[model samples]
Target: MTRLLNEEIIKKLVTMHDANRIIDQTFQGFGNKTVINPSKVSLDLGETGGYPFHEGFVNAMPAYIGDMDLAGIKWVSGIAGERREAGLPYISAMILLLDPRMGEFISVMEGTYISNLRTGAQTANSLKYLGFKDKVSIGMYGAGEQARFQLEAIADLYEITELRVWNHRRETAEIYANEMKQYVSGETIICNPEEGEKAAQAEILITVTNAQEPILLREWIKPGTVVFPMGSFQEVDDDLILSVDKIIVDHPDQALNRGALKKLHKEGRVTEENIFTTLGQLAIGAVEMPNFQEEIIMCIPIGTGAMDVSIAGHVYKRALEQGLGENYSFINYN
Candidate 1:
């Protein structure tokens, strides 16, 4: 039998806290070599040729967690513009869990929520392993749905007293502010129109933008700030990358191939020597946490399928235990 779970049902099955813990454990498994995340296969479609002409892409991400004996694949699709005008999510996905021993499908679930939620949970776990707590001010670039999840997940573990947001469009920033008022005080949510200076001058700076070039400069980063450039391409400049006290990433291969430092990696200016550690190492205590209070620590979380699959496995089990999802028999050949 295979369990079928939709986004709404999956949401009920896994909370942010659950996702955070699962992601932490998964990272630990990654560090200990009990987890495997293969490189994703991507199919890129040229521009849409519409108003925004956002590029479209689909990715197939597969993973296996040996300790738990869970294996899965996620098929996800996204576009640059996300069809926002038509009221659709930027990313939509589906996750299929398989019994590793038999390679048989055990469950299939909606993956968009899981995808957005787990990425945020991973970032929060990174902060936890890095030792951040209490009354943190957050500055964010790119006020979008993913940004909301980041703040939401972090607020579960920390006290967010202030939130400063910057977006290319002012209306979206205001919308984000209104949407995030539950976690951050309405009075403290400042929407910045300038070139991301006010947003960058916080204790925890995050960039979720889709910018191909750098928007955050080295000068804006304070001595004690923790930076997370969570976008696909470069959001922070070379100076910031070179000056950070410690550089941590989710995976070396993914980080070198994409994300903020990809350009530097290609230029032979950055390599494993430049990265201090990975989030997995930090989670497993293989690497010591840096002095986040006195140093500029930047964590580049390019995200991984291992985290998603692990969370999916957890959610599937929980749903089964609670009888939350619909069950259907599979491979019924007479």
Candidate 2:
């Protein structure tokens, strides 16, 4: 029995990102079967001053890494509210990793950071499989932490010659571009509002904004563009989705519902059957990746508790081996 802290989780997560071996290994090793109890609503639990909203999710997810000979349960709570003046995130969570063999509480940590990284990595991994490794014209749609991580991961994979970034606000986009210019190899170009699509016609496109409606139109997407849409949950327009000939996702089951693809499916424009392949299936050689030509290939991510648990499982082992976090009891009584 042991406990891993947020500091430990964050530390190990960063190390894992650098360790492409671990990212690649975990990307290929883990699998989860999730059953989500549809979101339940409760009124007036707490004050979210200045006009706020709250949405909650409860899920029981069990997962395994057959090669690692490890399995765990990651039960999570998703409560996201509009940002209050309290200076906190809009979404927060908790994850408990329990050992299936002994039923011990392996770890407990704040899940917000983990959720962002793993979800971001899921897209990064997809890009590794489907994106152009040699090309470098990069365009990112959002300028959040997820956006930063996605760009970092992309730079790791491709020879980014230009990083064209756009957000709704000019000042914010400039700040993000300036911050990025310090680290990445290429120039960080910021686009004005009207020029978003004009800037999007790069070798690679990453849409990570909190966009409710599709910001990048279907007709505007250039050929051979690989769009890694990070935050589009409800869905995108029919034209944008149907216009793309190929689709790839992290988990078909998860993305097929709460992601852009499902919204496309519901519109009678596309279905689960339309999914060409998934990253995991392709990684495992379960599905074959076709010749990715000059087409707009899309990878829509649906966040999963399994992604959290698997990453936690990896961190628990590596951090312990390196003598990282404090030890605590994880006991279960029958």
Candidate 3:
């Protein structure tokens, strides 16, 4: 029998704290070289006859965690603008959990919720292992679903004094500010387009936008601020990438193939040598901690399949314990 779970069932099975704990183990697995997370392959969906698929892409990510005995793959699609225009979710994903012993499929689960939650939990783990001030101020560049989760995780970890938001759409930012008040103890200011600097003044700056080009400048970044660019595309300037005292990543291969570092690597300006260390190394104490009070750091947290599989495996076990999901016989023993 194979278990089948949907988004609602997944929510009941896992919490943000659960995500944080699982992703922490995933990072440690990477540090200890017990995880196999191959670089994800992307299929670009070019313009398809009247459909807005020019910017659409599907990614296949697979990973295995040795210590936890977890293995799985996530197939996810990103069609932001087109889906948003049609009032549909911009991101969709599915996770398939596999038996480690015989490579049998055991569970099929919705992945969007897990993906978003793990992303935020990964950031929280970064802050925890890297260190952060007790009272934190966050500068958010996008007001989307990811931004909300990021705030939720951060708020749970620290006392948020202020949140400065700047979205390309002013109305969207305004609405986000009002709705996100539950996560903040202080104030949420909606920065104007011309006030990107004001929004960048914080202990942590997160860029979760879909901008194809750089919207954040090097000058806007302050000392001691940790910048997190969560998009698959470039959202911060080259100078900022070069000027950061330290750059951390989830996977060096994926970092060199995607995000702001990828473009810089192609131009012969950045290389694997320039990467200070991986989040895993930092999490496992394999590397020296940065002078976080005086130096700026860039932590590029690219999505990893190891995280998806680990989280999904945990969820599958929880579902079995709670008797939550439907189980159907996919293999007949006649």
Candidate 4:
């Protein structure tokens, strides 16, 4: 029998806290050599004109965790400009879990929420391990769905003193600020062009935009600041990338291929030598945090299959225990 869980059921079964723990455990498994994650496979569709000339892509991510005895693959789709034109999310994904022992399909669940929560948890975990201990202000470069999840997860873990937000569209920033006021007790500032520096000055800065060019500059960042560029495209310049005190990534290979540093990687401005350590190493105590005089640290996470499968496995168990999903047979026993 296969359990089929929808987004609502997955949401009911999993919380931000659960996602955080699951991601931590997944990283621990990676450190302990108990998780197998392959390079993600993606198929790009060039100007398909499906939604009036929009580009899109389909990606497949597969992983197995020995400790949890779980295996799964996430199939994800992304269509550019869908949100603005059609009011649809930019990305949609689903996960198929298989029994690790017999290779039998066990369950299927929505992966969009899992991706959001796990991505947020990854940042929260990075902040917990690598950020300043004192309460600090947070700055968001993009006010979108991913930014909302990042704020929610971070709020659950840290005591935020203030929030500063800027977006390409002021209306989006205003909407995000209004909605996030309930979560942030401190003041929320909607930044203007002149006041954009305020967001960059925050003790913790997070960039979640799908920009092709850099939006954050090295001059704007301050000492003792931690930055997270969480988008798939470039959001920070090479100067900022080269000037950071240390660079930490979820996975070296994936990070090098995408996010803020991809251009730098291609230009040979940054390499493996520039990376201080991976999040897994920090999670499992494989490497010590650098004791550097420079106070700026940047962490980048390109969402991984391990994170997806780990969260999926956790949600699957909880859904079964709580009787939240419908069960259907995938194979016939004759």
Candidate 5:
């Protein structure tokens, strides 16, 4: 029997805490070199006639986590410049879970929520392991859906003293700050006129923007500040990349293939040697944290298929326990 789970059910079953826990365990497996996650395959659908209004791409990510005994693939799509005009999400995805022993199909589930949640969990984990301060003052560059999840997951784990937000559109930042105020115990300020001022004030700076070029600069970054840039595109200047005290990635290959470090990696500005360690190494105590001094640290997550499988596996188990989805026979024995 294959269970069919919808977004509503997935949203109901998975929480920020669950995502953080699952991702933490998965990274431990990664640190132990026990998980198998191949590079994602992407197909560019450039100016395709199907989507007359927007360009899109499709990606397939597959993985197997040995420790959890779960195998799965996430098929996802992203369409550009449709959110405002078309009222559609920029990304959508689905996850297919398989029985590890027999290779039998187990369940099909919505993946957008899982994707957002796991990405957020990854950011939270980076902050947990690599960040210097117990209490943080956050400055965010973008106020989109992913930013919301990042706030939720981080807020669940730490005490945020202040959240200062800056977006290209002031109204968008204002709206996000208003909606997100409930999540933070401290003040949520929408930065106006001086965006760099806010970035300088942050103990933990996060950028989730889609900008193609750098918006953050090395001079603006303060000592002992941890930066998390969640987008594939560049958000910070090259000087920041070259001068950061330490650089940590979720996966080195994936980070180089995409994310904020990709451009630098391609141009020979940064390499595998420049990276301090992967977050997985930090998670499992495989690497030692350097002595705390006034330093700048950057953590970039390109997002991994193993993370998807781990969270999806957790959702599957909970759904099965509660009997939340409809089960149908996919294979017939005559």
Candidate 6:
């Protein structure tokens, strides 16, 4: 019966990351789950219609986490129109956590913050597994919130000496570079990617844009580089889709079907032949890393509800102990 807000969620996420103790237990998800995400429908202020929406997968994400045995549900409903409204986000989410013992509603809060954190967590994990430890340079495509979070997560995970950032917009890239300078306290290589910067410099490359087509052109990536295609799979070039020495996903069953790799497979551009391994398999020690070659390795995160709930449940338990939140009755039965 306690309520937590977005700001509260952000605090918890930050706290968890700072402590390096966020428990992530993800359930099964679709591999290359496809649905149209067009925005043709429109709606009046009072009346509702013209949602101008297209299909995107809605998933049931459930998980039990640590510290109070947290469990919750996250429904990832995709609709692309919110960006234009300047009110809602491209992705809208609703999450509910219940008392596992009694099945009573415990909390409901905005989910976008947590979603981005999950991506950030996975991105940090990717860097830990594939990135060169001594490399100080980070090349990022897409200067959005996720980009910021990726940098934050990386700094938390590594002693990033400096950064190199790129975005299509010069102003955005410059601003990002400058902001990063404040954080690094050292020389930074931040700028609009020098035509083909992806493959040129960064020891670690991250893509988090919304481009419908490729931004990280295959030829642009450097040899032995670890690439994180955090944005839509559609934005990564076909060459990258086919050329990588290792392709990893949080879950292959879902990654193979609905992940970017699956999208390529559907386009007849890539097949099972392209995917060398998945993170889950790697976590289970089913596969091993290859020699450092001029190879591009990309890992995709398909926001899992289980991970979300597990994290939230733990956060909620902590919040209650801190004497946070107010009790309210969501449903009144006389």
Ranking by TM-score: 3, 5, 4, 1, 2, 6
Local distance difference test values of all predictions, in order:
0.85, 0.64, 0.88, 0.84, 0.85, 0.60
* Model 6: residues with Cα > 4 Å off, grouped in runs: 9-13, 16-20, 23-51, 54-60, 64-69, 77-83, 131-136, 198-200, 268-273, 284-286, 332-334
Worst 10 contiguous positions by lDDT, candidate 1: 45-54
Off by over 4 Å in 1: 47-54, 81-87, 185-187
TM-score of each: 0.91, 0.83, 0.95, 0.93, 0.94, 0.79
- Cα lDDT tens digits, model 5, 255-314, are 887778888889988899988899889988889787644888888877999999899998
What is the C-alpha lDDT profile of model 6 across 38-87, one tens digit per residue?
Answer: 11122222112333344233555665543445567776655545444656
lDDT of 4 by residue, 127-228 (tens): 766734646689999999999999888887877789999998888899999998877878899997456677886788999987777888888988878889
> Tens digits of per-residue lDDT for model 3 on 108-216?
9999999999889888888877777577889999999999889888777778899999999889999999988998999888998778888998889999988878989
Q: Show the lowest summed lDDT stretch of 10 residues, model 5.
A: 45-54
Instruction: For candidate 1, write residues 115-159 as lDDT tens digits.
Output: 998989988888888888666788988888899999998988888
Root-mean-square deviation of Cα positions for candidate 2 versus the true structure, in angstroms:
4.4
Residue 102's C-alpha lDDT in candidate 6? Answer: 82
Best by TM-score: 3
TM-score of 1: 0.91
Clashes of each: 0, 2, 0, 0, 0, 23
How far is each candidate from the true structure, as Cα RMSD in Å? 2.8, 4.4, 2.1, 2.4, 2.4, 6.0
Q: Higher TM-score: candidate 2 or 5?
A: 5
Which candidate has the highest lDDT of all? 3
Model 2 poorest 10 in a row by lDDT = 33-42
